[model samples]
Target: MAGRKRRTLTAPARIVLCLLLAGISGYFLYHCALDVLTTFQLKEQIAQNKSQISELEDEQTALQEQKEKLQDPEYLKYMVRGKYLVTKDGEQVFKLPTTQDDS
Candidate 1:
């Protein structure tokens, strides 16, 4: 009968290999979770930014209309009188009373 030797890894080598595999798997899992979180955050940020952009565009349009209105002398005079209580020369200023009661 011939004798055969069995091949086996040492305890330290096995432990090291196990720790290495664990470390690699942990790193992969961590990065995968982080990637998901980052993607979610980016999507949220994009939606928020889009909303902000829409609001800014609306404001810009309103401002443009206001600018056009201000370019007209009659519109400017009306705005100044309504907003600032200002009157032109020889113009009579009248104040209207509000009918709403303050509770």
Candidate 2:
């Protein structure tokens, strides 16, 4: 009871200080929310890219195998015959309707 009362901010000063603090807090909250959203989006994009990369790698492997097969004359002959319906000389080809759509 003997100590002097501490000087406090006036009503207008207190209001202004509170308003400034609220503005700063809101700005920080908005920025933090934005960061979280951006992180989520980027993670999703990374996952999609990783899956795409794996798919492309698998396709590349398959294409490499096909290329290897093409280097062999027997496989090439079989592939051409099967895919293009080409035949050797004096060979007969029969065209049949497929059960499923071939294309």
Candidate 3:
């Protein structure tokens, strides 16, 4: 009996060893999968942020161009005349109704 005990693991001991190994493997796999998912999510967020930054930069460029245009006297005069209906001396003011075609 002593020699037999030394030669092989008992059935319950074998089961416990297998269960421990499986548990440890499962734990590591779960964490690895979680980390991979987190990395993908972070990468996706970074891509979205990059695209948004590019859009904002394009908008900033457009706004800068508009600001420069606003500084021009002729353009400013045109905008004022069109938007506020301002007229120079001896200029006839006409009120025209805007027609919208909804197709």
Residue by residue across 30-97, what tens digits does model 3's lDDT show? 99999999999999999999999999999999999999999999999999999899999999989889
| Model 2 whole-model lDDT (C-alpha atoms) | 0.97
- What pairs collide in candidate 2? none
User: Tens digit of lDDT per residue, candidate 1, span 1-103?
Assistant: 2688888999999999999999999999999999999999999999999999999999999999989999999998888899899987898888888798789
Per-candidate Cα lDDT values, in order, are: 0.95, 0.97, 0.97
Clashes of 1: 0
Q: In candidate 3, where is summed lDDT lowest over 10 consecutive residues?
A: 1-10
Candidate 3 at residue 13, lDDT?
98
How good is model 3 by TM-score?
A: 0.82
Task: In angstroms, give how far residue 74 of model 3 lies from its true place.
Answer: 1.1
Worst 10 contiguous positions by lDDT, candidate 2? 93-102
Off by over 4 Å in 1: 1-6, 10-12, 88-91, 101-103
The better-scoring model by TM-score among 1 and 3 is 3
Clashing residue pairs in all predictions, respectively, total 0, 0, 0
